[model samples]
Structure formats: C-alpha cells, structure tokens
Target: MSLFTRLATSYFFYFAILGLISPYLSVFLDGKGFTSVELGEIFAILTATKIVAPSLWAILADKTGQKLLIIRLGALLALLSFIVLFWLNSYWPISFCLALFSLFWTAILPQLEVFTLTSVRHSSKIYARIRLWGSLGFIVLAVVAGQVMEYYAPGNLLNSEANLFTNAFVWMGTVILLCLLISTMVIKPQRIVNKPQQQALAITGKLLDLRFIIFFMAGVLLQISFGPYYGFFALFLRDLAYPGVAVGLLISLGVVAEILIFIFASSFFKAFTLKAILIVSLAATALRWFIVALYAESIWLLALTQLIHAASFALFHSASMIFISEHFTRCQQSRGQAVYLGGVYGVGGAIGAYIAGVLWLDGLGASTTFLTASVSAFIAALLMLFWPKTIKKPSQ
Candidate 1:
C-alpha cells in the first residue's frame, strides 16, 4: 500500500480507540464511584504525562533515526499498560495504570505525525484528507460505545455493583489493546532521512523564535480552553436530562463537522493563508464556547454550534501542521510536534481540566465552565493576531 494509505489506516485504528476512550472514560470513572475531583485528577494525570513523554521520546527518535522503533515501542507499552487495568481496581492502582499507559500513549501520535509529514512532502493539504479517517473512526466508535453503555446502564443499578463498572473498564482496555496491535502491524517503519546530531539545546533554541513562541502560546491556550468541553460535555448533557442517543449525537455532530472540514481542507488551504485560517478557527472557538455556555439546552442551537468544530479544531490543527512543515527543518519536525502537543494539549489541558473540575464541583455548572472556555478562546484570538507573518505563508 501507499504511504498515505498506510498512515490513514494507522490513524483510523488509533483514533477509533481514542474515540471510545476519550468521551466515555470520564463516564466510566464516574461509574467507578470517582468524585468529580477524583476524575479531574485522573484526567490531569493523563495530560500531565504527555508533558514529558512525547518530548523525551522524540529526542530519542531524533538521535537514533528510529522513528518507527519508537512508535512500535510506545504502542506495545500502551497495550501492556492497558492490560494491567483489568487486574487493578482502587484509585491509586487505577491512576498508576493510566499514567503508565499514557507515558507510552503520548509518544505514538507525535512521532506518527512527523512520519506522515515527511512522507507527504509538498502535498500537506492531503494530510487532512488522511486525518479525516481518524475522525470517521472516532465517530463510529463513539456512537457504538455510547449504545453499549446505554444498553448496560439499564440492566445495572448504580451504587450497587462495582463489578459491572470493572467489566466496562476491561472492555474498553481490551478494545484499545486490539487497536494498538492492528496499528503496530499496519504502520511500516520509515528510515529517518534528516536525523539531528546537534544537542537538544540547539533545537530548543529554534522554539525561542518570537513567532513560533506566540503561536505555541496560542495553541496551548486553545487546548486549555477545551479542557472543560472535553471533560464534561457528556456529563453536562446527562445533567441536562439528555438521553444516551442524544449525547452520542451531540458528540458525533462535532466530529461530523470536523470530517467535512477534513474532506475539503486541502481546497480551503489553497484559497486562504494559514494565518487567516488560524484566526477564523480561533474566532469560531470563541463563539462555539459561548453558544455552549448560553444555549446548550436547545438541541438545535447546540447542533449548529457543533458545526463550528470544523473551524475550531480541524482548521486550527491543519494550519498548525502546515506551519510546522514550512517553518521547521525536517530534523526538528518531530520535536516541534512533540513540543506543541506537550505544551498545548499536555500542560494547558491539565490546567484547564483541573480548573473545570473545581468549577464543576463548586456548582458553577456547565454554563459557567463553558463561559470560561469562551473567554480563553477570545484571548487566544487576540494573541494570534500578532503571530509572525512569515509562518503564515506556504513555503516557496
């Protein structure tokens, strides 16, 4: 198979598991008798581990020119760590297992991204088309898992049978392990052609460029703002008395928009500058959060708001990938992606999730939490306005 085909397949399986795990993991933890505070702590731990794991793994891949090796190792480790969940039950043990799994889990995606970018040189627009496969996988698995959970919820009474929750957790872990296995087999190893020999400090110096730093800061804040949305969107729906099908549809609506963007992103990029897209995406995020904050109770309004995810996430992500491809040297690419993930999704998300958790328990409700997210996105837009113009243009 072609490189893009392979990469797309790999991403499909990887994100399919993520689709199942991400949206429902909090629900599962809640089922396990975890308080809001405890669930937040667990999510924080998972994100916090990304702060270190990706960068460290990227450094090793850079030095050895063994990108595929690192990915294989990460996938294997993730599979093993997830299996350990079947045997552990209590909070500390569960947290320990999650953190361990995340250590390896965090390493896989950034490295895969570096590989994809390298393989698809000069046709980066195609990246989104490939990435849309992941989104498709996410939508499918999330809907199926939502149905499964709903089916089981009626049969089991809460606060009575801990084993049912444990069974669900094990099932999630098993699905993840199977996906990792498939991803491992399908992703062919690529030789790293532009391996870095300089000390890590030299590469770190590149990030000091004011433009890159500003963009990174904006990206971090964007993700941080998403903390509450990701952590509590379903729970919020449940709180609003929405049924399982409605919750699944709400989640699927966002991804459907994302998929549409991915399908046409190459064309969109051809017509717009990366900075223009970035600004628009940030603005959409700001608006989306406000809608969620004020009008989430209206399903029609909420569904319309979900369409903005095309701009908020898909566009922003595509722009960032293009920016990295244009601005950074090939040798620096993996580390650049790793730093982006670690700083933005890792550090920023941890802070946002923790703060959101606090607000959630404090009775601030989803409206207030979402309003805070909107404020964060508005600030990110202001920051993006001053980003270096050089990074916005496609490479000559």
Candidate 2:
C-alpha cells in the first residue's frame, strides 16, 4: 500500500471505533439503568486517564526515540484491555475496564500525530487531509451503529448474551482497533534522535511561557465546552424524541462540514492568522451550542447548527496543530502534541464530562447544560484575543 493509504487506514479505524462510542456511550449506559451522575463519573474516569497517559508515553517516545514502538504497543494493549468489557456488567467493572483501556488507548494518538506530521514535513494542510479520513470513519460508524440499534433495539447495552447491538458494537470495535494495531506494525518507525532526560525537561520553560499559558487555557476551556455535547448529545436527541438514525445523521452532518473544511484548510490558513481562526472557532462554537440549547427541536435548525462544527472543531484543530507546531522546536514535537492533548484535552475533557453529568439531570437540564457550554466557548474566544501577535517559531 501507498504511504497515504497505510496512514489513512489507521486513522480510519482509530476514529471508526471512536464514532461507535462517542455519540452512543451515554445512550448505552442509560440503557443499563445508570443515573446521570454515574454516566458523568464514568465519562470522567474514561477521560481522566488521558490526563497522564499521553504525556507519559510521549516522554518515553522523546527519550527513547521509539514513537512507532510506543504507538504499536499502546494499540495492542488498549485492544486487549477493552475486551474485558464483554464480561463485566456492573458499574465498577465497566468503569475500571474503560479507564484502563483509555490509559493505553489515549497514548497512541499523540505519538501517531508526531509520526504523521513528520511524514508530511509539518504541512498542516496535508496533515489535515489525512486527519479528515478519521472524521469520515467517525461519520460512517456513527450512522451504521445508530441504524443497527434502531432496528434491533437491544434492551441492554452490555453483558447481555442475546443483545445484538452490544455484541456487534464490541466485536466491531475490537476489529477496528485491531486493524489500527496492524496498520501500526506495517508503518516504518519514526527515527527521532534520542533526547536526554534533561531534553524532556527542556520544555518546561516553553510550557511556562506567557503566550503558551494563555493559549493552553483557551484550548482547555474550548475542550471543556465539548462535555455536554460529547457526553449527552445522543441521549439529548432521544430526549427530544428524535429517532436513532436522525441522531446519527445530525452528528455526522457536523463532520461532513468538517471534511469540507479539511479539504480547504490551506485556504483558511492562508487567509487568516492562527489566532484569528482559534478565536472565530471558539466564538462560532458558542453560537452552535446555544442553538443546540434553544432550537434543537427543529431538524433544519439543528442541521444548520451542526455545520458550525466545521469551524468549531475542524478549523480550530487544524489551526492549533500549526500553532503548537510553531510554538515548539523540532525536538519538542512529540512532547508538544502530548502535553497539549494530554493536558488540555485530558484535564478539560474530564472536567467537562463530570460537569455535564451533574448538570444533565436526566434529560431535564439539557438546555441549561448546553447553555453552559456556550458560555464556556464564548469565554475561550475572548481569552484567545490576548495571544501575542508574534509567535515563537520552532528552533532550527
């Protein structure tokens, strides 16, 4: 296979599994009769591992120059851990399995990101093209899984022998993650020159830089704003009395727009500063969440709102990739990706999930929850305005 095909295959499967989980995890947990608080806590546990896993692995990758080794090992171990979910139905077992699985699972991506950007020589546009396939994977799995559940309507989401939906989801996720692992094995390893322990420590000054600090805070808030939508959007749709297929379609619609943005990411990057894109993305996301809170009952309006995801997620992500790339040196690449994803996404996502759980209130507080997300995003946008007009470029 060509290089793009090989890399794309991994991205496809990685996010295919994500699609199956993201929109539906709450719905699945609800079917198991878990309360909203429990769901929040579960999501938090699932996300909390992210706080440490990626950075730990990235440090090792930076120190050992074993990006591919870490990636492959992570994928293999993650798949193995997730399989234990099939045998456990209780809250603790399921929660523990998810947490352990995420610890490994979350490590794979930051390293792969380093590997990918290196492959394409840090061209954000080319990188965005490859990343969009992951989005496509998400859309495919989301729609298919939703339709499957709609047809079969499994009474239980887990630990049920005859549950077609549960069985199919687990088996398919296993196969996809397996495919991801196999894809990793085939790729040529990244040959990063091993950095000393102090090399890893060298990033501390950069991490504490004022611009980076503000940028990190804004990114964290933006990620935190995703909690309600990520944790409860599917269930929220159901609460609005929408069918399963519609729920998936609405979610997928956002990514369709994201795919388009990725296709034209270079143009946007050319047209705007990274800071501008970040601010606009955050601002637009606030509006998107507000719409979800106020006008979600209308399918047309909801579809329109989903389009904002192109700006909210895709544009911002592409810009952030370039921003982070510019902020660090060549030697700092792997650790940079890890710290941002692990620290920003990890910390922000855990808080978001927990808060979403508490505010969701079993479908009674959906609007309030989403409204809170809007305010978070809006504040994130306002914060990004203070980003230094001059960014520090990667050391040659």
Candidate 3:
C-alpha cells in the first residue's frame, strides 16, 4: 500500500480506541468507587503525563532518527500497562497503571501526525480526509461500546461494576495491541531529516515570538475550557437521570457533526483564513457550552448543542493542524506538533479537569462548570482576534 493509505489505516485504528475509551473511561472509573475528586485527579494525571512524555519521546526519536521505532515501543507499553490495570483495584495502583499507559499512549499520535504531514507536504488539503476516518472510527466504536455496556451491564449500579470495567479494559488493551502491530507493519523505513544547525537555532528563537506565544496561549485556554466536558459529561448526564444509551447517543451526535465538518473543511479553508475558522469555532463553542449549562434538561436542545461540535472541535482542530503545517519547516514539525498537543491539550486539559473536579465537589455542579467553560471560550474567541494575520515561514 501507499504511504497515505498506511497513515489512514493507522489513524482509523488509533482513533477507534479513542472513541471507545474517551466517552466511557470516566464512567468506568466512577464505577470503581472513585468520587468526582478522585476521578478528576486520575484524569489529570493521565493528561499531565502528556505534557512531558510526548516532547521527551519526540526528542529521542528526532535525535535517533527512530520515530517509528518509538511509536511502536509506546504502543507496546500502552498495551502492557492496561494488563496491570486488570489486576489492581486500589487508587494508587490504578493511578500508576493509568499514568504508565498514558505516558506511552500520549507519545504515539503527535509523532504520527508529523509523519503524515511530512509525507503529504504539498497536499495538505487532504489531511482532514485522512483524519476524518479517525472520527468515523470513533463514532462506530463509541456507539458499539455504549450498546455493549447497556446490554451486558445495564446501569452503573455497583453490583456488577467490576465485571463491566474489566471487560472494557480487555477491549481497550486488545485494540492497542492490534494498533501497534498494524503501525509496525505499515511504517516505511525513512531517515530522520535533521534541521540545519543555524535553522535549529532560529526555530528555538521563534518560540519567543509574541504571535507564537499568543497562539499557544489561546490553544491552551481552548483545551482548558473543554476539561469539564471531557472529564465528567457522562456523569453529569447520569446525575440528570439520562440513561447510558442516551448519553452515548448524545456523544455520538457530536462526533457525527465533527465528521461532517471534517469532510468539508478543506472547502471551508479555501473560503476563509485559518484564523477566521478558529474564531468561528470558538464562538460556536461558547454558545454550545452555555446551551448545555442551561438547557441540559431538554433532550432536543442538548442534542442540538452537540451538533455544534462540528464548529467547536472539528473546525478548530483542522485549522490548527493546517496552521502548524504551514508555519513549521520539516525538521521542526514533530516538536511543533508535540508542543501544540502538550502545551494545549495536555497541560491545559489537566488544569481544566482539576478545576472542574473542585467545582463538582464543591456542589457547583455540571451547569456551573459548563458556564465557566463558555466564558473561557468567549475569552478565547476575543484573543484569537488579535492573532497576526500571517505567520513567519520557517527559515530554510
């Protein structure tokens, strides 16, 4: 198969695991008798590992010219770490296992993103086409997992909680193993192209640029605002008396919208600048969160708000990737992507999740937490307005 085909396959499998895990893991952890605070701490730990692991691993891969090797190793470690989770029940042991899996799991995707962009350097318009497959995979796995949980385990009642979660862990571990094997098989052997000495220095210097700082800051804020939704949306629904299947369908609705946006993103980019796309996404996110905060009781309104996930997440992400691909040169690409993921999604998400935990514990509840997120997104939208219209091209 061709290189893009291989990357697409890897994306599909990688995101399938994400689809299965993201919507249900918090619910699973909650089933293990973890309180909101405990679950938040665990999720924060998992995300915090990303702040360090991806960059550290990327540096090693860049220096050793072994990006594929590192990805395979990370995937293998992620698979093994889940096994430890199966046998342990206490907070500390479970936290340690989650940390280990996250360390490896976090390292794989950014590197693969770098690989895909490098391979399709000039044809970047098709990036979403490849990535949308991941979204599709996510939709399928999430819906199926929800159905399975409902059929087998029914409610979140504690009587059969162990059985439900063990089954989830087994499924997650199996997918990771399969993804690693596929990743290993399809990765072409290629020499790591290093940046020229002077260029490397210049790239480091660019980190201090005001525009770059502002852009990164905005990215961080965006993820931070998403913290409550990622860490506790399911629990919130359950607390509101929504059934498991309804929660899953609500989550699936968002991804379906995301998939539609991704399918048409290239055209949208053609008509609008990356900054404009991002601005719209942030605005939509702001509105979406407010609706969730106030109208979560209404199923129709809740589902309507989820449809905005297209503008809020899919558009923003695609625009960000395009920006990174355009702004960074070949050698700096991997680390650039890592910084985006680490600084934005990793550190930012950890902070958001932690704060949401505190709010939930303090009885501020989901509505208030989502209101805070909406405010943050509004601020993020205003911040994006000040971004420079053009980014400096990486030095040759």
All models: lDDT? 0.80, 0.85, 0.78
Error of 1 at 160 (Å): 5.6
| Worst-scoring 10-residue span by lDDT in model 3 | 193-202
Highest lDDT against the true fold, candidate: 2
- Residue-level lDDT of model 2, residues 174-250, one tens digit each, is 88888889988888765555557446457888899988898899989998999998899988887787888898898
The predicted structure with the larger TM-score, 1 or 3, is 1
**Better lDDT candidate (1, 3):** 1
Report RMSD (Å) for each prediction in the order shown.
2.1, 2.5, 2.8
Q: Model 1, range 169-206, lDDT digits (tens) per residue?
A: 56776776677667667777765465345535356667
TM per model?
Answer: 0.94, 0.95, 0.92
Clashing pairs for model 1 are: none
Q: Candidate 3: which stretches are off by over 4 Å?
A: 152-162, 195-202, 362-364, 391-396
Ranking by lDDT: 2, 1, 3
Which sequence of candidate numbers ranks them by TM-score, best first? 2, 1, 3
Model 2: CA > 4 A from native: 154-163, 191-201, 392-396
